[model samples]
Target chain A: MLLFLSFLAIIMIASSHNAESKVHEIAKLNNEVRELRTHFVDGKTELMRLKMESSIVKKMMQKGLKRPERPPRKIIVKN
Target chain B: MAVKEKNILNRLYFIAACMFVFAIAVLVKLVNIQFVEGDMYRQKGQERVFKTFDIPANRGNLYDSKGNLLATSVPKYDIRFDALAVNEKDFRAHIKPLCEALSKEFGKSVSYYDKIIRTARSNKNRYLLLRRNLGYSQYMRVKKFPLFEFGANRGGLIVEQRTVREHPIGKIAERTVGYERRDEQGYYTRVGLEGAYGPFLRGKEGKRKKQKIAKNQWKPIGDANEVEPQDGFDVVSTIDVNIQDIAHHELLAQLEKFEAEHGTVVVMETKTGEIKAISNLGRTKTGRYYEKLNYAVGESHEPGSTFKLMTIVAALEDKVIDSSHVVDTEDGKVKFYDRTVRDSKWGGYGKISMAKAFELSSNTAFAKIIDQNYKNNPRKFVDRLINMGLGETLGLAIKGEGKPKIPYPGDDDWYGTTLPWMAHGYGVAITPLQTLAFYNAIANDGEMVKPRFIKEVKTWDKTRERFDKEILNPTICSKETAKIAQEMMKNVVKRGTADNIRTDNFGIAGKTGTCWGNYGKDKEREYISSFAGYFPVDKPIYSCIVVIHRPNKKKGYYGSEVAAPVFKTIATKIYNDIPVIDEVSYAVVESNAVVNSYDKYYQNAQKYKTIMPNVKGMPAMDVVALLENMGLRVKLEGVGKVKNQSIKPGTKVKINQTVRLELS
Candidate 1:
């Protein structure tokens, strides 16, 4: 009976330690998720700023590309 | 001797009685502490080790209609230092390298960091701020610095993280996007979309119980929480980032050119009444511009000549006037009892049709049109405007829509002059958005749709609610009247006051208005230049409005000069930006070159086995395959069909011999 009690006690201790390790792992993962989110926001903000139309026009002006003065034509083919 | 012995025995008895009493007193105190004070001690011990915590739910993100981030809550890092965390020897050894790293990363002078650190160390400042509001990458870079990498207990690096609202688009629509804040008295200041959708964006918080395991560390006691957190749903607004960017820049350029006090522009989808872009800019004392307020939604002022559209629509629908009816300008000076109205031109336009009167925006013409036609029954004109939905607010999603006021026949401000003055857009008030809605209706074939900002509220893929087009009125005017108004507006750009802003890319039909504000002698009069219209005279898609207040009088201040250019640019750019689809017939036609090659390949495969077959003129591909199939290895040397072979042709079938065939 005494041996059985000690075995049960050992199982309880092992389980507690397992739980503690998981807690530490969760804390580390939470920190990593936050940092990744921060980096993602930074990249997205920069992309939106660069993709803005005004910025694109300014960039293309250096290469001599500008808005056309005339409207585009629609072509239709008859069979 | 017997008497002395007796006295000593008596003293011994007295001493024994005292010892017995002292022992009894000790037992009583022990029982008291164990039974009576035990509960208080146990409670104190429990209070130190266990706690209940409130876990905050993650706030939802705000997104544009194109699924781009408008506003979101992100973790911002503030780094602090514990000056005396390290011993004197360690501090001395690593201080120079630590300061050097900080200088390199943050672009501060080395002496700046050195002085601050030394001062902090001498003063024993436990919480010295190193950097505040560092982004994630910057925080990690600082964490990897030489001395700070040793961590909190030793190197004394402290980090405090909290969530803050961030706008990815910067200051483009900062005022319209807005935020929510709570004061010390627990009052929330809600502004714009965030404040409007607080219930959906702010989810329910959760709770959990934990036990203290180490200093400043708590271990959750169980896997399940007492209450689970519900994260906020993402809010998608109907703001096209591309259009917003163009509108913002175009308005800024015009405002800077005119050195205007303030300006506002709004572009809305005519069919659905979706506000695609809106920009409001105010000038600073130092000649800079920023999004100062939501003037498009909140500011109500007299719309000078743009109001003429409503007047014409009312008259045409009332069957009181037609485009062909001629109205004499009479030198462009017309009097209304006490006030005199004059045209901008010196000699005034000669007798012209009502259509010409509208295209030129003659104040006397419209004044005469409404005054003479409705003078007997002014109530008819006022009721016409009221029925057109111009005497009330738009009932917008965001708060603070300026109320539009249309004077009635018996109102306190009503006078004999009010009829003609109101004809020329005076003694009247309407928000810029309201005027755009009216124009948008004219573009939508008289179907008046309310302006909408939010497209939907959703969580991931499941939609909580969807917003559809809410029609305010079936028709603001008859189809015939709307057509006439559209044509006249197109004429305004084609050969009218706004001719300076004509573009070949698309047809812009609108009216230009330049009104004077603060006209009394006590204050200097300022010019409010505005243009209101829609584009593509054939089929209208979007209606836009631009209002610029108090432009410099020295430079041009007419609506044609200051405001119409912005309208034209926005319309032309938007028209050119729409993607066009081209169809290319993709029928597979068997070419002659392919068929000949296939026939050659088949003929070469039929014959030639285990013996030398004259393959000199044969294609390299056919030759290689023909030889290799008979248990020989094949190798190709060059490209396109085939050219030459290393071994003559087949010779004999070998188990593993490489045939180097060259291709042309």
Candidate 2:
């Protein structure tokens, strides 16, 4: 009876530890996913900005050297 | 006494027998507990609880030399459903809204989602994969929906993470970098630079066990066991990005301007042979072109009159002909083996110097030089050409570089007319890069270095194996011979055929080659107009070649007319961009021609001058004195310093003529 109780206790500890590790991993992955999404969005924004500027410049060139209006800077909040 | 002793002994024996039976029962009970029934008790005590999913490791990113992202991985989500866990009544009721949300997010119609959900509903034991690679934002929005808001497990919805590839500067250097694809063998592969350095880019794959919740559902057990991916090293190219942009634009413009089918322009560093800009493009019906082929090394065409530079060099190296050594043109047509090779303009160009013949791209002249020297042994000529790096394959970093086509005597393809035609850059085919390399060799003071595209192969650790410039040799001539050949080419631009490139600011020393090719159909003449040159003429820095093939008639498709101008435009831009190190001597070439115009202006000034005004602290007196010497009159008035003068110093007057003088 004493040995059986001890074996059950050990199994319970192992299962809890496994679950703990899995939860920790999920949390870390969640952070990575958040970071990647932000970066992807930023990249897209940059591409759009470049495209707009290039077309503006092209139009300006056609008009014989007029300056294009710069686009407003996006304000990003940091935690 | 005997009866009493017997009774006691029997009682002791029975007691001992009972003790042995008790020990045997205990032994059997211990065996059953420890060995036979142990597994059942252990199974009853443990519970197989929460399962895990193994998250796939994200792939590394590829960056360019300037820390610009070439390719990168972005996080994407996959939607899955655990059919077994989903309550049938509640699931069926919520299924329509869920499908509608999926259709909205995926940009698909409601019917498509219906079909997908219908099939997924068929297998209750399985976790159905709804979609793969949804954006994180899309997933977040979908998760906020009322039906999907109950969290993943309760609603039986699952999201798995994956990485997607992205190019920051799409289509720039696309062909050279290449793409990755899975082949028929089920193995993933990459091509070009990406493929060549794939191992470094791929990094190591991390392993982990995932808990299989359902047949298809898995939850990662631990920290997506991150063997934190080491990103691919940045490729620092020898190419100057600005120059590459300029070359691309100019090459495209020239190709279309000539209505040429396709063309390539490679601007390489003179000494290092580091290709700064290589623009290889093929034309399309849309007018805009794509980099469909690496024509700079892949396409080999007879380089036409440009090949004359080689023949001239060979002849000069052999001491068979000097720059002044005249070759007979006769009728400007050479009939060898019933094949008449005539100059484009026809009729004899008179008995001109060898330099003039080269300048005019005279076929007959080079034909005479080749026939006179290498005719007895054609292999000797071909061998000499090969020795000059004509037919050799340049072991460049990029694969599929063509083996340069050159004819040799006794080869099955060789004909009687081969030597003469080869002399004028025909009957033997070579790529634009090979021809450019040969010219670049001459420009590099006769030291031939193989053209290098990749400057370094960098590893993941940021350590680089630098590909230093390899000098093949001092080539088939002494520096003197190379100089003479270079100067002869310089004269071609200075006064010869390529004078169209001459600008007041820069001197262009180069050659023009216009040749007709069969293209696809036999004997349908299509011209390949090309100009190969280096500038500034005094000190060579850049050797550029512009080849415009099959230009429409409207574009005036001559090498000088089309290609030389492009060369000038690109050279001018390069000159403006690069620091001008050595100043080109812009002194008059012909000193004896005239001082007469300047003398006439001086005489007119003398005829206009008169003066001898008040000479005391008067501004006008200076002018008066100057006018006095120049035979002109001047009247001086008020002065702090030459404040006023009546007659200007330049006013016309006879010698010793008097004029009024005034002072303030």
**Residue lDDT tens for model 2, B1-664:** 5679889999999999999999999999999998999997776543243333233444444544434445556767787776656667767788788878878777899888777766776755356887776666677787775456776666777878766666555555556556566578958665555565555556554455455566665555544543443445445456555566568777777777677788778888888888777777787888777777778877788888999988888777777779998888888887998788888776878788898898888889888778888888877777777888887877776666777888778889788788888999988788888888888888887899888765655654555666788887666567888898888888888888888787766677789988877745566677888999888777777888888777885767678887888888788877755543443445554553236434543554454434323333334434455555765445544554543444445444577565655555
For candidate 1, write residues B203-311 as lDDT tens digits.
8988888889877888788846578788899888888888888899999999999999999999998889988888999999999999998899999999888899999
Give the TM-score comparing model 1 with the true structure, all chains together: 0.83
I-RMSD for candidate 1: 4.2
TM-score of each: 0.83, 0.65
Which residue segments of model 1 deviate by more than 4 Å?
A: A68-79, B1-51, B86-97, B212-217, B222-225, B582-664
**Top-scoring candidate (lDDT):** 1
TM-score of chain B of 1: 0.82
DockQ in order: 0.34, 0.04
